[model samples]
Structure formats: structure tokens, C-alpha cells
Target: MITKIAQIEILPGQEDAFEKAVTEALPLFLAADGCDGVDLQRSVEHPSRYRLMVRWETVKHHTVTFRASDAFTRWRALAGPHFAAPPKVEHVYPVLAH
Candidate 1:
């Protein structure tokens, strides 16, 4: 599996609403064709920051399939407005040893 991490920084007071939107959109990720699972993490030191981790059967599933689908638009509709800036997204493979 490949893991895609999106580092998000929301506007100072938007965290609550952002989390709510993400919660409502959780099933969208799970229902995607090649998605395995996903999780959202909040920083204790920086409450306005979030890390969205999504696991996919392959990188193409995220980069191509999901990104090109209506679900992506829906996700962006919910989460995009709260973004302090464009998210930093990347895909990585498990090291296993680490």
C-alpha cells in the first residue's frame, strides 16, 4: 500500500468546522475504488495544523483516480475553504524496519 499525507494548516478559528467537515466526508474516502483507509491527526502544539493520511492500494489510485473523480471535488468543497494555504501532499511507502 502507499500512504498519502496531506499537511494542512487551517485558519486559526476554523479547526472545529474543518474537523466537522472532514468527519462528514470520511466515508467518501473509504468508498473510493482503491482506497484502503484514512486518518486525520491534529498537532498538540499547533492546534491549527492537521495531517491527513490516506492509504491506497497504489499511488495511482490517489494521484489519478481519486484526484480525477467527483469525490475529490466534494472533498475540496468541504475542506478547501479552511486551508491557510495549499496543502502539502506526498505519497510514501512503508519502510517496515523503521
Candidate 2:
């Protein structure tokens, strides 16, 4: 599996707006082809920071398939204004497990 993590720092007072936008935009992932699941979380220490953790069957599923889809564009457009800056995204692989 592939994991994609997006860390976003939202503008101070725009937290509520960003949350609302993410809630409304969550459904777009339902149609994604290789998506296993996705979760959005807010940091307890820094409420204005959020994380989007996505699990995909393959890296291509996100880098190519999802990224190239119209849904992605819509998602971006809808959430773009809520961001304090462009999100920093990272792709990772699990190396060890308990």
C-alpha cells in the first residue's frame, strides 16, 4: 500500500472555513479508483494545522490516477482559499511493524 500525507497550515481564523470545506469535499474520494481509504485530522497542539492521510493500492493511484482526475481539480478549487499556504505532501512506505 501507499500512504500519502498532506500537512496543511490553515490561516488562523479560517479554521472553521477550512474544516467545512474539507467536510464538504470528502466525498470526492469515494470515486477514486485505487483509493483504500482517507482520513483528515486536526492537530491537538496546533488547531490550525491539519493532516490528510490517504491509503492507496499503489503510488500511481495517487500520483497519476487521482492527481489527473477532474475530482482532484474540484477538490483543490474548493479548498484552495482555506489554506494559509500550499500544503506540504509526502509519500511514505511502511518499513517495520509490531
Number of the top-ranking candidate, with lDDT as the measure: 1
lDDT of 2 at 98: 85
* Tens digits of lDDT, candidate 2, 5-76: 999999899988888888777788767988888899999999999999889888899999999999899889
Candidate 2 displacement at residue 79 in angstroms? 1.0
Candidate that would win on TM-score: 1
TM-score of each: 0.96, 0.92
Please estimate how well model 2 matches the true structure, expressed as its whole-model Cα lDDT.
0.89
What is the TM-score (0 to 1) of candidate 2? 0.92
Model 1, residue 71: displacement in angstroms?
0.5
* Regions of model 1 farther than 4 Å from truth: none
- Residue pairs whose backbone atoms clash in candidate 2: none
Kindly state the number of residue pairs that clash in model 1.
0
